[model samples]
Target: MRLASLSLRYKILDFLYKVYPEAVEELTIIHVFYEYHTVDDIKKHLNYLVDKGYIEQKEICLRLGTKKTTNIYKITSKGIDLMQGIIQDKAIPIPEDE
Candidate 1:
């Protein structure tokens, strides 16, 4: 379970890194992993990233028709550093291909 959680976190960071500077909607992130993980599981990993200062989360309100609030996540400088090997977290193992 612990390994799985770490892998999920790493993948989340990787995805966010690939799209750096662009925030991803919560639903979109969840949808990407819906086949193997529950919404709650994906949320938990997102929260973990936020708490670690590796990612930033913000709530955006859309007024298209009605007021709708949603979360958007983006990787932070620290997260980029981790991806670049300037910093490291044992839990999130760096991928070799990177």
Candidate 2:
């Protein structure tokens, strides 16, 4: 993992650790924490985490008489290991521009 990934991973793990089982919007995460990250970038990183088996996404439907759906993210034990420095990281990277 690069520093950029590590940073985002840390932030996300911290967030999910603080609010497990509760859904949070990607926009809300960008607005509140990763101010410099775009939704696309965040989504890409999340996809990476998913591919790496560090987190899981739950697609839920709303019951407002509509077909609306929401994507809620949750961290896995592997992700917690990485966040806690149990997983080795690779080269360092910088924060990207939105």
Candidate 3:
């Protein structure tokens, strides 16, 4: 899938993986995108991540008297291994000043 080729998906997956232990509140993703995009963009990107199996979906109740609807992503082990390789392969070593 071309979706697998996009770097943005990787970024989103990395973010989710890093935050998986936390609650991953909805607003957290919005804050992550504040500099360049809107919350809608993040939501769309998250949907793509869901389709790619890098993230999971779950309904969450954000408030009382409202139907619970949210995508809670849990990073898969395969995703962790993939991200680790990507990070390692792309890392650039910094030189120390003598």
Candidate 4:
């Protein structure tokens, strides 16, 4: 079954936050481990993060008698702030819902 966009987004966040510091590649086998079928879905979430200023992207072209485009991704300061917020929020004790 396909994962929800929210789940995918969190998985992405966890990946970038803990697993891979350099999660720049357009296609990653590790994404499949996180239940991503293709790069398009992952790219969609990455674009959303970029639009929200939680991340940044850089385009690098390869020349080998042909042009190849690759996207390089990096978590921005805003993303680090977001992560810290999440950590703090999780640290606070809250009553469990019955």
**What do the candidate models score in CA lDDT, each in turn?**
0.92, 0.65, 0.59, 0.59
Give the alpha carbon lDDT tens digit for every residue of 1-98 in model 4. Answer: 23365556555655566644675555552355445345676777778877877677887776666689777777777666666664322322222330
Judging by lDDT against the true structure, name the best candidate: 1
| Alpha-carbon runs more than 4 Å astray in model 1 | none
Ranking by lDDT: 1, 2, 4, 3
Cα error of candidate 1 at position 97, Å = 3.0
Give the TM-scores of the predictions, in the order they appear.
Answer: 0.91, 0.69, 0.62, 0.64
Ranking by TM-score: 1, 2, 4, 3
Per-residue lDDT, model 4, residue 19, is 45
TM-score of 4: 0.64
Clash counts for the predictions, in order: 0, 0, 0, 0
Superposed on all Cα atoms, model 2 deviates from the true structure by an RMSD in Å of: 5.4
Tens-digit lDDT track for model 3 on 1-98?
Answer: 34333545666666776776554655666677656666676777777666655566676876788986664566666556556664222221111230
Clashing pairs for model 3 are none
Off by over 4 Å in 4: 1-3, 19-23, 29-38, 63-66, 86-98
Which pairs of residues collide in model 4? none
Candidate with maximal TM-score = 1
Looking at model 2, residue 66 earns an lDDT score of 80
